[model samples]
Target: MDYDDAYANVPHIPDGESYPPRWAAEAAAFREARATDRNDLGVSYGDTPRQAYDLFRPETAPKGTLVFVHGGYWLRFDRSYWSHLATGALARGWSVAMPSYDLCPDVRIAGITTQVARAIQNIAESEPGPLTLAGHSAGGHLVSRMIQPGLLPIDVTDRITTITPISPVSDLRPLLHTAMNAQFQLTEDTATAESPALMTERLDIPTHIWVGADERPVFLDQARWQADAWSCPLRIDKGRHHFDIIDALKDPVSPLMRDILG
Candidate 1:
C-alpha cells in the first residue's frame, strides 16, 4: 500500500488547505469576544514557550474540566487555532484547557506525549473535579497514551472520568512506513512502544473511540483498533470527514459534546 497517501488527509478533503486559515480567524474572534476575564491566554505549563495552555471558563462554577488537544500530526498548528472548540464544553459549564506542544523534528513524539501529560497535570492542579479529555488525530493518540499504566500520576488518573479519541492514530508501526517518518524518527521498538493499540493494559477509565464515517478508511480502522484493544465504545459520526468531523464540538447539544461531557 502507498502508506504516505493512505495517511495523507489534505489531498483527499476538498479545499482542505482552507481550513487552517478559517480556524485561525474563528479562534482569534473567539479570543477577542471571550476576553481575558474568563479566558486565560498563554498560561505556562512548562518552561518552553510552546508549552503554554489557554484556559476558557464558563459563566458559572464549572462542574469539571475538559481538556481538548488539537492535531497536526504532531507537526503543525497550536492551541491558538482551537479556542473556539471550547465553546460546547463551556456552554455546558465545563472549563476547557487547550495546550500547545513543541512539534516533531524539534521534539520527538514521545517528548510531546510527556508534555501533554504535564499540561493536563497543570490543569488538574488548578481546575479541580473530574477530568474529561477529547483529542483529535495526533492529539487522540496523545490522550490514549495518557491512559497507559505509569504514564500519569495515580491521583490524576483516578480523577479522569472519560476520554474520547477522535480519529486517532492508534498504531505507530504503520507510520514508520509513511513519508512523515523522517520527522517522527521511529524505530521498530519505539513505534511499538508508542502504540496505544499495542498496550496490554490501561488506566480502566471509560474510553470512547470516535471517527468520521466519511474519513479515510485507515482512520476508521485505527479507531476500531483502539476500541477493540481497550474494550471501549466507538462512534462514527455520519456524513463527516476527518477535516470537518470535529466541527460539532462547537455545538453544546451536539452528540459529540454529549459523548465528551457525559
Candidate 2:
C-alpha cells in the first residue's frame, strides 16, 4: 500500500525541509523578545531531559490554560520549535504550555503518551481555570487519547473544556505496514490500543477535529475517521497543507485560536 509514502508530508509540501529551520529561528526570536517573567523555560515535568515543558504566561490574569503538543510523527522536533505558537493564546490572556516528550526509537508511542499525560497533569497543577488541549499530527493522536477513561486524573479530566486535534492520526492500524514501524515497534494489539478512533466511550469533553483541505488524502481521511468515530464537528481549513495549517496558532483572532480559546 506504500504506507510510508502515504503518510509522508515533507516531500509533498513544496520546500517543506525549510520549515523546521524557519520555525526554530522564529521560536528563538520569540523567546528572546518575550519578557522573562512571562516565559518559564525548561520546567521539569518528569525526570528525563526531554520530559520538561515550556510555560508561557499572559500579561494579566489568565482566563484558562491551553496545552499544545507538537507533531513530528513521534520522531522529530521538540518543545523549542513550537514556543512561538503560544503567542496567540498568550495574547488572548491564556497561559500556554508546550511539552517535549521522548520520541520513538528511544521510547514506544505508549510511553510517549504517558509522558504527555504526566506533563499535562504537571501543568494543570500550577495553572488554574478551564483547560483546552490542541495537538498536531502525532500529537493530535496523543491529545485525543487523553479523553479515554482513566488516562488522566479525574480532577484534570473534569477541568478539560475542549480539545482540538489538528490533522491527527486517529487510527494507527494503517501504520503497521509502514517501514517506520520498525522504529515504532507497534504490534497489532498495541496499534489498536493506541488508536483513539477505536474507543466507544470518551470523557464527555467537547472535541473538534481539524484538518487542512489541501493535505494528503490520507490525512483528510484520518481526520474524517475521527470526526465520524466521535460524532463531532470537523473543520477543513481551506488552502492549507499539513505544515502551514498550524500557522494559525500564531494569530489570536484566527479561527483556530478563537475555537480553542473561546
Candidate 3:
C-alpha cells in the first residue's frame, strides 16, 4: 500500500489514552522484568548527570548488541520500560541497551539528540562488538540522529552494522502543524534543521525503514521518504499499527524483526 493508504488506517487518538493499550501493557511488563536485571550506567553530556542508559544482557550467551532508544514523541517514555524489548534479542543471543534522555520543550530536540549520541558512545565503549541499532517513533528519529555520518565520534559509529528505525519521524515539519506541537513546540527552522528527510545525509551501514500498515500518514510517508532518499529497505508490516508493529520485535522470528536484525 502507498503511504496515504497506510496512513488512513491509523486509529484516532482518544481523549484519555495517548498510546494504545497493548503497547502500554507491554511496556509495563518490560519495565517489571527490568527491575530485576537493570544495570544503570552514567554517561556525561556536558557535565550533567541527566544522561544515562541501562544495559540488559542475556546471562549465558550473546551474539551482538541491539541498542534501543525509547520514543514518546520526543517528550515521554524512558529506558526503564524499554528493557522488555530485549526479550526477543536475548533469546537470539543479542544483548539490548536502552538509553534515557531529557525530553523536549524542556530541552530542545537538538540537545536531546546529542545526549542520545553520547549514550550510544558510552555503551559502545564498554561493549565493543558487532552492533545493530533500532528505535521506535521519536526514538527512531533519535537513532537516525545517532548514526548521522560525521556526527558520531569514530569508535561508536564504526561498530554499527545495521540500523532499523521503525515508524520514525524523519520529517518534523508536519508535526509542527499537528497537535504534537503541544510538547514538541517545533519551530519551522528547528523542524527543518532536525529532520533527517531534509538533511540529505546517509549512513554507510545498511539501513532499514519500517512503518506499520496503519501508522499516521505522515509517519508512513516519512519512512518511505527516508527509504527512497537513502536507497534503504522499506517494509510495511501488514495488519499492524504504529504501536503494535514494534510488539512484533518481542518475537525474534517476526518478519519485521528479522529484517531489522539481519
Tens-digit lDDT track of model 1 for 90-157: 89999999999999999999999999999999999998899999999999999999998887889999
**Which TM-score value belongs to model 1?**
0.98
| Cα lDDT, model 3, residue 250 | 83
List residue ranges in candidate 3 displaced over 4 A: 1-50
Arrange candidates by lDDT, highest first: which order? 2, 1, 3
Q: What does candidate 2's lDDT look like per residue over 1-262, in tens digits?
A: 6888999999999999999999999999999999999888999999899999999999999999999999998998999999989989988999999999999999999999999999999999999999999999999999999999898999999999999999999999999999999999999999999999998778899998899999999999999999999999999999999999999999999999978987
What number of backbone clashes does candidate 2 have, counting pairs of residues 3 or more apart or in separate chains? 0
For model 1, the run of ten residues with the poorest summed lDDT: 200-209
TM-score list, all predictions: 0.98, 0.99, 0.85
lDDT of each: 0.93, 0.94, 0.75
Off by over 4 Å in 1: none
1 against 3, candidate with superior TM-score: 1
